[model samples]
Target: MRGETRTVWPAARRVAGGLALLGAATVGYGVYERDAYTLTRREVPILAPGAAPLRLLHLSDLHVTPGQTRKFDWLGELGRLVPDLVAMTGDVLSHQDSSAPLRRALAPLYAFPGVFIPGNNDYYVPKPRSPHHYFKRHPGGPHKGPALDWDGFAKDLVADSGWRDMTHVHDVLTIGGRRLDVRGVDDARSRRDRVALVAGPPEPGADVVLGLSHTPEPRVLDAFTADGVQLTLSGHTHGGQIRLPFVGALVTNCGLDPSRARGLSRWSAAGPDGAQRMSWLHVSAGLGTSPYAPIRLGCRPEATLLTLVPAR
Candidate 1:
């Protein structure tokens, strides 16, 4: 009886160990394949929806490395959703020299009307540092600003893709009876932006006005809101890149509170009666990272789908 009991015990222990190993592998796969698996949903309000609902696709931060055709294919798949208009809020490429690949990746997006703004990464190359070195303080925090030539890059992009260049400019377009006034600025950290390029007290006839920026700095958002822009889109913070389960994102690069760092939030202005008039602010968690900094822990990159619901 003792020998038979011992034999059973060994078999049970072996099965338990095998199960544990399998569990570990499963968890590892879940984390590694997170990018391909995760999709986040966020709905934003469009004040005056025209005859039919308009779907807008917001794509941001494709920090592409050279030879990443797979990433480009994923971007092309975005068209499958049939967005009426698309907005790109910067960091389209990791290196200024690699703009060609970013252009190629965005070629599929040209099927619809698209507007673009550049992030610091596109114009200001981060100094080379160790793989996990982003945690360490920059000691001086980059006294010298972004070195890229904005005019040249903007020109090349326009010529190459035929997309509207929203760098320090404003333009209006009509989409199904709704007029979209787009006001955009260059990266704020570098002071390359000038609000005057797109300044105005909102045109009386437009349904909505969009304010664009790579970083959602308070001053920048204020400028647009003061101008009566109804909505603002930004994507400099990678949704804190690594988010913890219930606690959410660890850090947002800007001054925005962590809760408002990545999704739909409300920005309001007070009227004569002291009632708050609000607008929708949508920030994408972004799609990729700089080639040098390649791993994203808890946050999966995103392409936001903002469906315009008429004011109820």
Candidate 2:
């Protein structure tokens, strides 16, 4: 029995040591990949036939704080793209004063016409918690911490800078020589979304119709689809923030499926008649993570530039 015990102990120690090294390596890589930002570009066929192409830039889940100089610089550089319209789904501040950093991150985007709504993170700060909490069906404790300065930021953007506030409303605008019927709701995760207020078919004479939200909960998305939104944009998944090789995202942190956690995909839901309706859905992996749990694995931070061309 003593001889057997000695052999088993050595083997167990070797396995434990190996696992510890692997865990350390993973943490190292996640930290390194956090700042390894990239831009994802895609072409969507949502424009009218023979219509001139329009550039649309989709940015989301900024979650920016001070000292992230690299993020500030990269965002400033996107001005060269000169997108005709910019759609920012929010999560802009991370509990900082946000006066300078918010301006530093978003002021350049205001060079063009844009529309945005606030995320839960914009209303209050996220408290530090274990990463494991994220995987559970229902995370406990207070999700929000200190209050953020959302009103000041809104005034600066909407009142002063001419950007539309798309929170819980639908409106029509002419952009790039085409009529656009745009609708959006607040962050759906916190039950702030009021899709009923903006519910209805696409407006007449609109060249395109779309919707936006911070969290892409299926019910909100389904409502948008039923309302005849041809395209829908959302963020807050962060592409699971820690993807695996073959298995991919273990959880989306929301009701969204793991497969469609990030990037472009078709969203379909059943209508009243039980027939399936579909629309183009683009979920930004997002530009940053919550400051408290700032690590990424196979998924890198990203912004998407979607070139909208004529429908096939």
Residue pairs in collision within model 2:
none
lDDT tens per residue, model 2, 18-41: 999999998899889988889899
Lowest lDDT sum, 10 consecutive residues, model 1, at 136-145
lDDT of 1 by residue, 159-228 (tens): 8767788888887877766788888998874566687788876766777788899987766776777677
Once fitted onto the true fold, the runs of candidate 1 whose alpha carbons sit more than 4 angstroms away are 1-41, 49-51, 130-140, 143-150, 269-276
Top model number, TM-score: 2
* Model 2 misplaced regions, further than 4 Å: 1-14, 270-275
Provide the overall lDDT of each model, using Cα atoms, as 2-decimal numbers: 0.73, 0.86
Model 2, residue 118: C-alpha shift (Å): 1.0
Clash tally, candidates in order: 0, 0
TM-score of 2: 0.93
* Candidate 2 accuracy as lDDT: 0.86
TM-score versus the correct structure, for each prediction: 0.80, 0.93
